[model samples]
Structure formats: structure tokens, C-alpha cells
Target: MSEPVIWREPVVEEWIDYNGHLSEPYYVLVFGHATDAVMDAVGLGPAYRSEHDASLYTVEAHVRYLDEVSLGVDLEVRSSVIGVTGKLLWIWHEMYADGRLRATEEVLGVHVTGGSSSPLPDEVAAAARALLVEAPEEASGQIALRR
Candidate 1:
């Protein structure tokens, strides 16, 4: 089996917040790029979107911030395609820095064409299925408040 794809980016000064760490929005930004990387891997990237006028649209998402990320850190986001149907896809991302998991995100998206949900093309669907993996235990859960 081929190794899973990993996306990487360094945190920039502009991404830092007043708390002196990676900003919340930037975490989402990196996760979004990781999603794009998945699209590219599965043949649903920019070129395909332009040629076919179809793309993936996120329908729901959940993110957990587990640790602080400092500026200039090389962030690695390990992404997995946990599930896929005709039109729906589920992805999970684990963000790490200094070999520690700093955050995670889970997203649900739909293949869309002409502004409507549509089935993925045969080739793209097959490629996505090939990348399928079992969902991580930490993937889906609501945050609980500490009493």
C-alpha cells in the first residue's frame, strides 16, 4: 500500500494572535489547504474543477484545538479520507508540530456541479475510494464543557 499523503506549511508571523500563538483562523486555513491537497490527490483539484465545472463544497466541519502552535513552526497535517459515497465525502485532519498533535478537524463535503450536489465522476470516485481509511477514534465528537 502507498503511504498516506501529508501536507505541510510553516506558520507565519501574520498568523500569530495576541496570545502569541497561531491564530484560530490560521488553523482553519491550514486545514482548508489540507483539504485542497486531498482534492488534488483524488483528481478533484483545480484543473478538474475548471474543466468539469464541479467541485467539493464543505457542508459541515468540527475542529479541536489541543495545543499552542508557535510562529515559524513547520506544521504537518496528516489527512485521511474516512468515507465517501456517490455525492458525499468525509475527511479528517490531524495537525502536528514538534511531533505532537496540536489540532484536528473533521469535515463533510458534497460534490457539486452547477451549484447543485452531484455524484463524483467515475474516475474521481474510484480514486477517492482507493484512498479510503478507517475513521480515527477521535474523529467525531461534541466538545464537553468542564464543570
Candidate 2:
């Protein structure tokens, strides 16, 4: 499988900081929202929370901001499953603008229920596993396109 575009939205006015670039926190926000889309795709969204009283909690995260994302441009988050465990999921996201690589975010998350760690529900686990993509044998982390 390949990375899928999990979420996208324009860089709006409010996301801009006094320096005229996307604010530090908004970078997290945009990537975090993309993670939510990954959860939702795996049947762990609002409906799952309503039915199972469970949700995934972000356990660790790392964001590398590579370039400036200008305002009013649409930012696309391409995501893929890195790995999965009995109770945790690992995901990666790459944010882009005008086809330029902008940022990369990786997160580790755990399923929680009743305030304690819980086994990931079957539906979500299956969906996530189906999307897993291993890095190519000779792949560079950055898939840059040159002119």
C-alpha cells in the first residue's frame, strides 16, 4: 500500500502568526487533525466513541517543519501506517503545499477505555493493518521531486 491523503485544508488567516508563516501550534493542529482522520477511517470515530466508550490517545509525537507554508494555500496531509501493536498504533504524516514537501509528523497512540489502556477494537485494528506500508528497501525518508 501507499501513503494516502488522509486530510486537507487551506492555510487560513487565523493559522498565520505575526511572522506571516503558519504558527508553531497550528502545525501540530493540522497534523493532529489528520491523525483523527486516520482513526475515523478505521471505524474509530464519533460513532465508535458513542458505541464503545473508547478512543485513542496520542502517546508520543514528533513534528519536523521543513519549509514555510504560505497562507491561503491548501495543505495536504499524506499519511500511512508505520506499524501496529496489540494496543497501539504508529502513524506518519507528510504535509505538502503546491506540491512542495513542507512537514512530517509521526505519532504513537494507544487505545483507551474507562481511563485505562485497552485492546484496540477489532474493526479499527483490521482497518489500520490493511494500510500498513513498509519503507522501501532503498528509500530516502524525503521523496523530493527535482526540476
Candidate 3:
């Protein structure tokens, strides 16, 4: 099997906030792009959506920001398919900058067509399953108050 896809994005000036750091929403945006890349890798990309009106809809996401990022840095996101079902997919992405883990996002997406959940194509399902790995320990966890 091939290695999983790594999505990369440069931190542009527009993504910075008044605090002189990467903004909160841009992290989600980068993760969203990573999700799209995964869909494309599994044959659920724009072509598939246009052909069958089927697409993956993110129903939930949990993002953990572990460090602040500055502008002009290139961010790399490594994505993995942690779990997959006939109609649902669970993916995790780790964002890194300067060789350090900066953030992580775990997403749950459902295959949808005509506004209803539907089973993924057999080929796509198999492809997604091929990429599955053990879920991260922090995945699906809630932010707890540090006492």
C-alpha cells in the first residue's frame, strides 16, 4: 500500500490575527483542505460528486490547538483514516510546523447523496479501509479543565 497523503499549506498574511499569530479559523480551514485531499485520494472528489451527486459531509470535528503558529511558515498536515464504515468515515490530521506538532483535528464525515446518508461506493469504501490505522489516543476526547 502507498503512504497516506500529506497536505501542505503556506501561512499567508491574511491568515494572521491581530495577536500576530495564525488565526483560529485558518487552522480549521487547513484541516478542511486536508479532508478534501483524503476524499480525492479515495475517489470521492469533485468528479465523483459531480457524477453521482454524492459527497462526504463533515458532521462533527474536534480540534486541539497545542501551539501557536506564526505567519510565513509552511504548515504540513498528515492525514489518516482511522475508521471507516459503509456510510461514515473517521479521519485524523496532525498539523506540523518546523518539525513540531502544532495542532490536530479529528473529523467524522458521512457519505451523503440527495441530502441523505448513503453507502459509499465499493471501490471507494475499500480504498478508504485500506488507509485505516489505529486511532490516536487523543482522538474523540473532550477538552478537560486542567486543575
Candidate 4:
């Protein structure tokens, strides 16, 4: 299997929870940003949307929270394309904080245009396929978990 795409970010003060660790919701937000990066890489970003009047929409997500993340922590999310169909894309993300696996997010998304389902763009499909990887040991856990 190939290496998962690494999406990195620093935990700012605003991301901390009352317990002094990263908030639960922030985990999903960070992963959302990482997903945006993946979409951009696949030619489904803002420019593509502007030009084609189409965009990718998250259809479903199963987010698992495994550990805690503290403020000022550096986070790196390793994401991989689990699979893709004609109009759907499946993705997985493993989030790490201080080198510890802290969270995982699995998502299914669809391409849409004019308020209706649309075919995945060729460039987007090619990119997602190129980034596909075998599910890591971590991914074998529960398919869905609460934030």
C-alpha cells in the first residue's frame, strides 16, 4: 500500500476546549480542511466549481475520536482514498497529535451540479485513484464513531 496523504496543521489557541485539549468538533473541522485539500488536488476545488458549476458534497461521515489533543499541538492527518464509484468517493483520514493517533474520519461524498447528482470529473477520478491505498491497521476499527 502507498503512504496516506499527510495533512498537517498546528492547533491554535482557539481550538482548545474547556478541558485544555482540542475540542471534539475541531477534529472534524480539521479533517474537513484536509478533505478540501484532497478535493483541490483532484481538480474539484473552487476553480473547478466556478468553471463547471459543480462541486463535491459530503454525503456521509463516520468520525471516530480515539484520544485527546492539547492546545498548541501539531496535528498531521494521513488520508487515503478508500474507493470511488461513478459519482461517489470514499475516503479515510487518520489524525495524529503529538505523534499519537487521536482520531479517524471516514467519509462518502458525491459530485453534484445544478442541484442534482453528477458524474465525477475525469481529473478528479484519476487523482483519487492515484491516491488510493490499502486500509491501514487502524482503519479496521469501527466504521463509525461519535465525535
Encode model 1's per-residue lDDT on 55-115: one tens digit a residue. 9999999999999999989999999899989998899899999999999999999999989
Clashing pairs in 1: none
CA lDDT, every model vs. true structure: 0.92, 0.85, 0.94, 0.86
Best by TM-score: 3
For all predictions, the C-alpha RMSD in Å is 1.3, 5.1, 1.3, 3.1
lDDT of 3 by residue, 29-105 (tens): 99999999999999999999999988999999999999999999999999999999989999999999999999999
| Least well predicted 10-residue stretch by lDDT in candidate 4 | 135-144
* Candidate 1 steric clashes: 0
Tens-digit lDDT track of model 4 for 10-116: 99999888899888889999999989878887788898889988988999888888898987789999888888889998889989988889999988899999889
Question: If the candidates were sorted by their lDDT against the true structure, best first, what order would they fall in?
Answer: 3, 1, 4, 2
TM-score per candidate, chains pooled: 0.95, 0.89, 0.96, 0.89
* Shift of residue 17 alpha carbon in model 2, Å: 1.1
- What is candidate 3's CA lDDT for residue 60? 97
